[model samples]
Every structure is written in C-alpha cells, then in structure tokens.
Target: MTVPATAAGRWASLWGLAIVPLLLLGAVLAYLVATGGGLKTLQGPPVEQLKVSRVTLPERGVIQVHLVNDGPQTVTVPQVMVDDAFWSFTAQPAGPIPRLGRATLTIPYPWVDGEAHKVALLTSLGTVFEAEIPVATLTPQPGRDLFVRFGLVGLYVGVVPVVLGMLWFPWMRRLSARAMNFILALTVGLLVYLAVGTYLDAQEFAAALPAFWQGTPAVLLIALLTLGVLLALGGKRQPEEAPLGLSYRIATGIGLHNLGEGLAIGAAFALGEAALGTFLILGFTLHNITEGLGIVAPVVRQKPRFIQFALLALIAGGPAILGTWLGGFAFNPVLATIFLAVGVGAIVQVVWEVGRLVARNTAALGAPLVGWSTLGGFTVGVALMYFTAFFVKF
Candidate 1:
C-alpha cells in the first residue's frame, strides 16, 4: 500500500509546509510559559498596583472615580479617604478586581470650588493609591446643553476656519507654477508640524494609562501600523484618478487631526477647565485654517465645482463634532491615545503625498525643488503652527 514516488513527494512537501507553522507555534508557547506570559510574578509580600483612570464631579458635592487593577493579583479596595478624612464610598461590581479589571467608586464629599482635593484608596494589601484634583469644579455631564456647547466649539474651530481657508481656492488657482510649488511645500510643513504634535499628544495620553497596558509601546505600534496601512491604501494615483480623490484624502487626514483636537477640548471641559477649553478653541481655529489650504491644493488645478468644495470642507471638519461628543461623554485615555496615533499616521501619509506633488511640480517647471521659495514657505508654515500652538496647553 505504499504510495508512488511522485505522490509521496507531494505529500512530503505538504507536511513540510504544515510542520513549519506547527514548530513556530510550539516555540511561541514555550517562550510564553518561560516568561510567565510576560507578567511579573509576585515573589514576596502581596503586591498591588492601582490606577485612577478618571475622576468626575457629576454633581455639586459628589465625586466619581474610575479604577483599574494593574497589578499581578486581585486587589480589594476596602477603605476610602477624602482630604485626609475617612469617607464612606460604594464600589460598583463590589469585589476584588482581578488583573486589568476595572471598577467605579462613588463618594459623597462636599468639595469646595477653586480648591485642591486629594482622594485616596486603601487596598486590602495595605497599599495606598492617591488621586489629586488640582482644581475643584463640576465635571460636564451629558445633556442637551452640553451637546450644544460642544457642537458650537467644534463648528467654530473645525468647520468655520476650514471653510474660510477654502475660500482662498479662487486665489490659489491664479498663482504661477512656481508659486503653486511653494504653497504645496507650505502644506507639507504644516502637516509635518501637525504630525509631530499629534504624536507627542498621543504619547502624553499613553503615559496616563495603567502600567500593565504598556502604553508607550502600544502607541508606537499603533502609529506605525496606521502609517503603513495608509501608505498602502494611497500607494500611487493613476492618471485617470480625479484630483478630487487626493483632495479628499488630504481632508480625511486633517479631519482626523481635528478629531483629536476636539477630543482634547472636550476632555478639558469634562475636567471642568473652562479656561483651557476656551483657549483651545481659539488656538485650533487659527491653526486649522491652514489645513483648508492643504485640502484644496490638489483640487484647485482640477477646478472642482462648489459642491465638491462643500464636501471637502465637511470631510475635513465634521469629525471634530463627533470627537467632542465622545470625549465629553465617554473619554477614555486608551481610546484617545489610539485616535491621536491614527491622526499622526494619516498626516504623515498626506505629507508624503504632498511632497511628491511638490517635487513633480518643480520638475515640470524645470526648477530646483529645494529652492528659496520652498524653504521659506516651509519655514513660515512651521512657524505659523508653533505660534498658534501657544494657545493650547496641557
């Protein structure tokens, strides 16, 4: 019943292909077991680590805290203290929180306005975790009033400015070839600044997450993955592809960046920082006007219709409203960090594509790509962004 040599060779090849994956899987299992699944094993006394992921003042005299167990074992929060005074509190899903598990604790404390307060949690393992409120103010609750307020902010910061910038399309269409290159270079500069800022913001948010989440590595991986995916999606445009396509892509990138901006504003307001939120509105309004120019640069040559321009404006600015809603109602540090990373990646992709367009334009004009106009335009773009950023603070 032995198989023929030809059939036996085919079977051998199939087995070989299957064995490679099987061996690799076995290796992964062995590595995981040896490293204890990348978790630190407590060697001595009960080790507990807790993270205060968020704090909210839903009403005038009550505090809500979100907690996550970021340790190697289960930990129970047995006592709570506010401002060094013992206070009674209730925990949702009362019990010990296992590794990476989450819970919410509500405490009724008469916190005064314009003052600082400290909330402390005493764990079963005799470890204390403290969360500080730098300023006592009422957190924004989800409601029609809050929704309308956030919407107005987004409209001012995202939509109005972008539409105004797009208004320059008529003027942009009249520029010389050399001048067009300069404008495109300026767009690249603007996008580069945005990308860097978004990435830094992502890192900041990542640092606020629980230690067990490996936030830094996660941000790096997600940002890189986003960049790779976007590049693949926009690898090369065919001649038949309309210029509107490129413009839409640019709008999409700017829209994502604006979404991050909206999240920042909403979170600031959620934390009751009215001043910071107001400043953000002003700063982003100025900063994002330049984004409209970037979006329209590719399409000006195409002479796209008015309806097309309207679509571009919406595509570029509409996300801010959605972002505000999420950040105001359900802000999560991990989600915010991921979104910022995505914005960074999208902007980087747009910058690459825009740079290529600039280079191509320069070559068509038989001029040097890195001339004075390009350099100066880029400098001005970066400088403008930096100057506007003075309004946005952590």
Candidate 2:
C-alpha cells in the first residue's frame, strides 16, 4: 500500500518530535548511572587499602607524599595523618587499581621540625593504615608556574562561547558562519596547546615510575588513546533532525560531552589541585556556552519559538551539573584526552558547515566585514589565553 506524501511527512514529523524528549530522558539516566545511582555513600570505593611507599617534605612550607596501592580492590584515602598530627590530604581515587594499578596521594605538612612521623590513610571504612617515615625538610623552591598556568589556559578557553553569545545576538545570525569558523579555529589552537602542554606534562610526572612500572606511562597513554577513539566512533544508530533545531543524536552527544567536561573540573578541584580545578572550570564553562550556541544555531535558522530555544539551552546545560559531581571522584588523564579529542572532532564538523554558509553569504556582507569579524573572533581567543595565563599561576 502506497501512503500519501503528506501522510509520510506527518509521520516523520511526529517521530522526530517524540525522539528529543526520549533522548533527553536517557541523558538524565546515563548521568545518574555515571554518578553511582545518585547515592552519596556509594560515591566512593567500598574499601581503600594502600601500601605507603615514600614521604618527602620537598619544601619546608609544604610536604608531599606519594602512595602506591598494592591492593586487590579500589580505595579512597580520604585523609592522612602524620605522627598523630592532622594534615590536609588530597586523595586521587583512580578506581579499582586493577590488582596493582598505582595511585598518588599528595598532602601538606605545616610543622617544619617534627620527630620522625607516622603516616596513616583514613578510609571511608574507618580503618587506618599507617607507615612511619623520616622527613627531610628543605628550603622551598618554587615549582614552575606551568602547573597553574595550564589550568588557567583551560579557564580562558571556556569563556569564549559565552562572550560570543552575549556580543552576537539574533540580529547577528547572519554573521554566525564566520563567527563559528573563528571559534573553531581558536578551539583547535587551544586543544592543540592543551594536548601538548598539559597532557604531555602530566605524562612526564607519571614517567618517574619505579623500575617495575617504568614503561607504564607509555603503555597507558596508548591504551587510553585507543579507548577514546573507539568510544567516540562506536555508538548507537543515528537519528533524524528535528524542526526545533537539533536532532536527538547531536543533543545527546553534546550533553554527554558537557557532562564529562564538568566532571573534569570537579574532580580536579576535589583532589586539592586548586589551580588545575580553576582552569578546568573556566575552560569547560566557556566550552559549554559555545555548545549551547551550537544547539540553538541551527534552530535559530529554522526561526523556532523562543520557548524552544530556551529548552535547547536547558538540555545542554543540565548535563553539566551531573558532570561536575562525577568529576569530583574520577580523574584520568587518558580519559580526559579522549573527551578532548571527541570535542575537537565535533567542533571541526561544525566549522566546516559554517564555512559553507560564509561562502554562500559573502555577497550579503562585503569582504571587509567578514575580515573584521574573523579577526574579532581570533582576538577573543587570544585574550582568553592571556587571561588564563594570568589567573592560573603558582
């Protein structure tokens, strides 16, 4: 039986309308799962067991200790004690240590001269594992500002989308293509910088592994890269575009990306790496704004109702809250790299489409306007880099 063209079109429309809400609901569910069923107690590992390897007071002001987990299961070392003295500790919970996977714990030491101290790991299970080690306190030499600066870099990168949105409104829709292209180029620059500057540096820190695990850094990097590619490329079936401006597929993808970015920020902060946390927060914040624009840009093209535009923004932003909470617990450089790469790919696709639009609209705006707008976009990116550098310093 041949259905009328009108009937076919209506059916397609109805299916498209039904899909968005379903996808949104799924996104919420996935977020809940990632965050451990939304239960506070279940947020961390059931048990945290560790074998203390070494402790060093690299500087008189602050002491740093590195722990190696030789445990069977995942553990969270919530606090550490030295000689029965309370010291602030930042536990990096990398989950399940896989029978021998190592994790590091950094703690601050306030007392300059204390008799040889005993270190203890206070787990959620209320169990204490203690190891006594001698402390050598030396004059504090400032570590390079690179650690803090990289975080700021993330922050500035995050502000771009919000700035652009505020400056360029509905009337500026005509300029969207050129603006997006500029944003894409800027994002590429930042990502490349982060990939080399931040990711490589972290790898270097991990490279000082014991002889038994000297090759772990390289092996882990490769494994993470492969996993990232697979996850980004291998996913569910595609969906039809909706009249409201986005398809279920794209919205869900963006939502997931935002959520992940939020987690990166939250986890960084939770680990007591304040500089890194600030940077990630700023970077993701700006990144989310751009994503919001991406969601609404196409819908704006369709001249949708204001209510629809607002709904789209909420969908993109909603996932960020989930991401922030999840990030507080999990911090994996390889995983972060994968998410960064996926974002780069999506931004590239958007830039290509925008370029086509710009080419088509050249006649509408003279060459000078296009040139100026592009330059303006690039400047915004540069400014972000500078701001990040300034704020994230040791």
lDDT on C-alpha atoms for all candidate structures: 0.86, 0.49
Best by TM-score: 1
Clash pairs for candidate 1: none
TM for every model, in the order presented, reads: 0.89, 0.41
Model 2, range 1-394, lDDT digits (tens) per residue?
A: 4569889999999999999899999999999878766686755645455655445555455555556655555556666777687687665554334445566666676644634566777765777877654433342233345334433433333333433443334653665655555553344333333333333333433443333344344544553554455446534323224324232223444544554555556555544456676666655554445444434444444555666545554454545555454444334444444444444344333333334444444445455535655556545644555455443333
TM-score of 2: 0.41
lDDT of 2 at 289: 50
lDDT of 2: 0.49
TM-score: model 1 vs. ground truth: 0.89
Per-residue accuracy of model 1 over 226-319 as CA lDDT, tens digit each: 8899888775657557468878888887888888888888887777777888888888888888888888988777868889889999988998
At residue 276, candidate 2 shows an lDDT of: 73
User: What is residue 83's positional error in candidate 1, in angstroms?
Assistant: 0.3
